[model samples]
Target: MSETETIYDQIEIEDFTFDPDTQLFTYPCPCGDRFQISIYDLQDGENIAVCPSCSLMCEIIFDEIDLQEYLDQIS
Candidate 1:
């Protein structure tokens, strides 16, 4: 199966909490742990956020321009 087929859901970037300290975006996962993706990964054009405690993964939906704007603000 493809990566797209493995995605549990599609979550908006805004729905995640951004931690400037770690530059990680996180969201609550059904498995009781958070799903996480790094800003660097996003910058590298990666959109999948994974739960470290489980097999669940989510596709993050965001615009490149919007991500840049957010990064500028945090920086």
Candidate 2:
């Protein structure tokens, strides 16, 4: 038997849309749904964007400091 690991593609944070009102970052997934991650999740050191319609996820690369700035402005 062989085991396969799910590998998620790494994406630039700029590729995702940051909603100021909802504070959620979203990107279009190949599954026709959006990959989403919240600013609170990012603040907690999470960078994974998961598609609600599928078992696909990606890492969002971003600077923690820059994220904080956005959070601050919204707050």
What TM-score number comes out for model 2?
Answer: 0.84
The root-mean-square deviation over C-alpha atoms between each candidate and the true structure, in angstroms, is 2.0, 3.3
Overall lDDT per candidate, in order of appearance:
0.89, 0.84
Candidate 2 Cα deviation (angstroms), residue 40:
0.6
Measured by TM-score, how close is model 1 to the native structure?
0.88
Off by over 4 Å in 1: 1-5
| Stretches > 4 Å off in candidate 2 | 1-5
Q: All candidates' TM-scores?
A: 0.88, 0.84
- Candidate 2, residue 36: CA error in Å? 0.2
**How well is each residue in 16-73 modelled by candidate 2, as lDDT tens digits?**
8989898999998888999999999998998888888998888898988869666776
Error of 1 at 40 (Å): 0.8
